[model samples]
Target: MKYNTILFDLDGTLTDSRPGITKSAVYALESFGFTDLNPDELNFFIGPPLLDTFMQHYGFKEEKAHKAIAKFRERYNVTGVFENSAYEGIHEELRKLKEAGMTLAIATSKPHDIMLRVIERYELAPFFTAVEGSKVDDTGYRKSQILKEVFEDLHTTDLSKVLMVGDRFHDIEAANDCGIDSMGVLYGYGSREELESYHATYITENVSGLAKEILTCE
Candidate 1:
């Protein structure tokens, strides 16, 4: 294998979490007095940090954005979390990678507390060597910071042998910033143009193809 360690994103990558997230987003936006938001419109919320997304897209200031995040969690923790489902073939491929002795881990913007719950709910804890997620505080931890912590947890500094895999520009951009290769998956939320624009080292559209890419040298 060309890479010894692989980092996977949570939302829109391993699982289709839109229903959960957008539904909860509805709850939050409604609480913020914006009632016309289409759940479809919240697709951008799938991969990025809620604080920044709200501030950037909805014009929320930091204080109001923090409250919106709280409202998001209010519903998300109770119901929105379980509204997600894993993609077909992902679990089997993750098993294939694990059995092949590759180090697998999760690096997600989902808050650390909630990420733990979601991982257990989806039964994905067994395959990973390390799992890192964003803090539940008011801060939106950058993907770069999250990946840096992941590298430390995995005890690997050879960025050449590491791969970051996800379905968003944020994931690829962070890998680029951290000097690691990245694989952008189209089966998730990101488009080929989005991934290519960010210069992902590899791109695939399905979990099986992703497995082939990982297990093969080229």
Candidate 2:
């Protein structure tokens, strides 16, 4: 590929972190007297905005959702982040991409601070040129807003040359909003059917397969 930057999503794309997210989310729900989250339900909250999960599933008003977000961060910052791991082949693949002269960036919906901690802990931070994520205070948690921040930081002139790589429909949707190509990973939170429904330009079944797919993209 002739692209300069490859923007990746965190959570499902880089880490298989449903367990940590599930635990922390349930803790937040329990702290607020809501008990509707089963493990499976909690898994659904992994890739999207945390506040959206709180509001949709718990019926929490914005004020209460913000409080729950704070509590969620308290637990997540202390413990949940370490509960995740980089996917197999991810580190090597990222290093290879970086060495190949690609400018790597992270455009995730996770809070920027949390994303930084996870990236640094996993030693993934060294591979990327820049990491852009959602607000640290639980604001602008949408994928589109995060992508905009990343593009602005990179001073990218060609949106068509940018590729969004993620494991969910939100990533694909955000790429559509930004008028860029997107590739969905089947190994993440979203299923093939959902990714196809969003019309992902490409799809990779594994981390090792990503480089090949990207090279083949127009």
Candidate 3:
């Protein structure tokens, strides 16, 4: 269970971006004349790609999904992106991992530029060795694709020594596809049932638990 490298998912695993994402989603829905879209009901937007969320949750066609994404970015890029906060103890956990000599990286569905802004704003840029994310153009939104890019940037072939930590089924599934282990956190948007169904290697209820699991791993 030893790992030398850890890939993190940005939105839920490290930071609580629910407010920003939900607000932006509501803005997008409003643009389509759906003024009643509840921000609380938009929790599904936290982990997955915007395009998929728009289509899957709202029944938007591909073309309309793209448009909705644009509208989301219009607000998100200005206000929503900054409307986020790091989870409690996340900084301490990351510092501990870094001090232990583990390489850390970010693999997120968020666009690369925006992810960078978020990380930098939160002062998390120092801990991660690399950050790979989807493009603003909406390409490379799949967790698997994002992780592939992260692995490529890392230039590491030993998947056994790599661990991906996230809060969604997509993260675990992507780790499985990449031949790596994964840890799911419950303090984020995803449910325990979802993580378990995806066969995550481990699940933790909070940042402290997650830190303990990572530090104690073989």
Candidate 4:
């Protein structure tokens, strides 16, 4: 294999989490006396980190954005995270990659605690060797920072031998930051143009195709 470790993004990549995310976001906005965001507007929040979503999309102040995040978690923790489901054939693809002796890891912008809960809920915890999510600590919520941490955890100094896969510009940027190639998936929430704008090395129509492409890169 060309890469020793593969990093996957959680939301919009491995899982269909829009319904739960949109519901929680709406609840948060309503909690702070904001108007309900339409589906299109809510879609704008999917790929980026939650704090950035609140501040950029809703124009929330720093403190208010933090409160919105807290409110979103109130509902998300209860149901939103559990409401998620893995994409069709993803489990099978992961199994294939694992059998091929490739190390798998999750590098998501979601909070670490919540990511752990979702991973456990979906029964995907065992598939990945590492699950690195956004911490409310100094690393902030950048995808690059998350990937860097995962690479460190893997103890792999050669990032060029690691592949980053996701469904958004953030994923492409993260890979670029780490000097690695990235594969963008069309099955995710983001549009193909968005992925293209970031100049992803490979783009897949679905999970099975993604598996083929990843293996090819090796």
Candidate 5:
């Protein structure tokens, strides 16, 4: 492997965002009077765009999904966002990759402005070269779309020099769709079975392993 540019997924790949995302999902569902819904059950919302997740799991129409996202953001923006923490060892690995002269970037389904806030809070901005994400509405952008945006923003010239690292199928699939290689992480929201099923180019169990995979140039 000869990757020089690494595109990372935000939530599961870099940070443990389940608590805040699940809480906001619970808040949004409860606002719709789905009071019995458990926050833990909403863990699936951590990776993909909220609109797609809400629509898939809850069968919300596009309009209703938009409304649900608005409700999700109501809590997410104020409190839920702050409830997150970067995974253990994530910062150290990012620093190692930066020191190795890797061009790191973020291509996530998370909304762009909120992503900026998170990067600042976690002190991750210095490591990434660029960032691309969905709009607050999460309307038209999928992982593939935003990944392409980041790809273009970074002016990537050789597809072989890029890698997409994430924990979900959406991330791997988008990388596949974009003709880039992918590495799936198991210590995040996704399972080994899911990553393998997608045939990710590589799969690692944790942050340190992930960094080793990249830095080894193998």
Candidate 6:
């Protein structure tokens, strides 16, 4: 294994969380009397911080964005959370990496509590050595900040041996911030152009391809 420690992004990278995320966003918007919102248009909410997504897409102020996030979690925590599914081949790839003696960890902007619930729901907790995510209050939502906690939890400072794998530019940017390598997945919500523009070290078209890249990384 070229990289001994692998950090993963939860939402777009590990799971197809689009349905739960977009539906929750729609529910939140509807609560504020914003009807007729299309879930397809809300795909941007998948990878980034929910508060930032609400503010950026809807021009909501900070306070209102927080309210919108609160509403989103109201539905997500109960119903939408379990609506997610692990990507095809994800479990097998994770098991392969774990058996290869690689250290796998989750570093996501999703709330830590919700992350745990989702992993448990999918029976993916056994493969990971550590799981790190944002606080429930939306504090520590940035990908880079979350990665810091993940690295700290893993007790490692050697960025050279760490690799971040995700489907969004934020994941690449965060890895760049930490001076570690990053691989972007094309099968998730992000476009190929988006991942390339962020200068990801490698871009794989699917989970199998991603696993190959990690196992063969120089």
lDDT for model 1 comes to: 0.88
Look at candidate 1 and give me any clashing residue pairs: none
lDDT of 1 by residue, 26-69 (tens): 99999878877799877888888888989999899999999898
lDDT of 3 by residue, 4-120 (tens): 999999999999999999999999899999976789998998878888888887798899999998999899999999899998889999998988889999998888889999999
**In model 3, which runs have C-alpha deviations exceeding 4 angstroms?**
none
Against the reference, the lDDT scores of all candidates come to 0.88, 0.85, 0.89, 0.83, 0.88, 0.88
Every model: Cα RMSD to truth = 1.3, 1.7, 1.3, 1.9, 1.3, 1.3
Where does candidate 2 have its weakest 10-residue lDDT segment? 133-142
Lowest-scoring 10 consecutive residues by lDDT in candidate 3? 133-142
Candidate 2: regions farther than 4 A off: none
Residue runs of model 4 more than 4 Å from their true location after superposition: 39-41, 137-140
Better of 1 and 5 by lDDT: 1
- Model 6, range 61-132, lDDT digits (tens) per residue? 988989888899899989998889999889989987887789999998888888999999898899999998
Error of 2 at 85 (Å): 0.3
Against the hidden reference, what TM-scores do the models get? 0.96, 0.93, 0.96, 0.93, 0.96, 0.96
Q: Model 2: per-residue lDDT, tens digit, 71-162?
A: 88778878887889999999878877777778889999887888888999888998887798777554436789888988999999998789
Best by lDDT: 3
1-218 in candidate 5: lDDT tens per residue?
Answer: 38899999999989998999999999999998897877787779888878788889889999999998889889999999989998889999998888878999999888899899998999888899899888764654788999889878988889888999999999999999999999999888998899999889998887875677887756
For candidate 2, the per-residue lDDT at 126 reads 89
Output the TM-score of candidate 3.
0.96
Instruction: Give the local distance difference test score of model 4.
Output: 0.83
Which lDDT tens digits does candidate 4 get at residues 1-218? 68778899999888888888888888888888878466446866676887777888678887888888889889988988877798888888988889889999999988898788888877788889988988862124788988888978888888778889999888998899889999898888878899899989888877776666788884
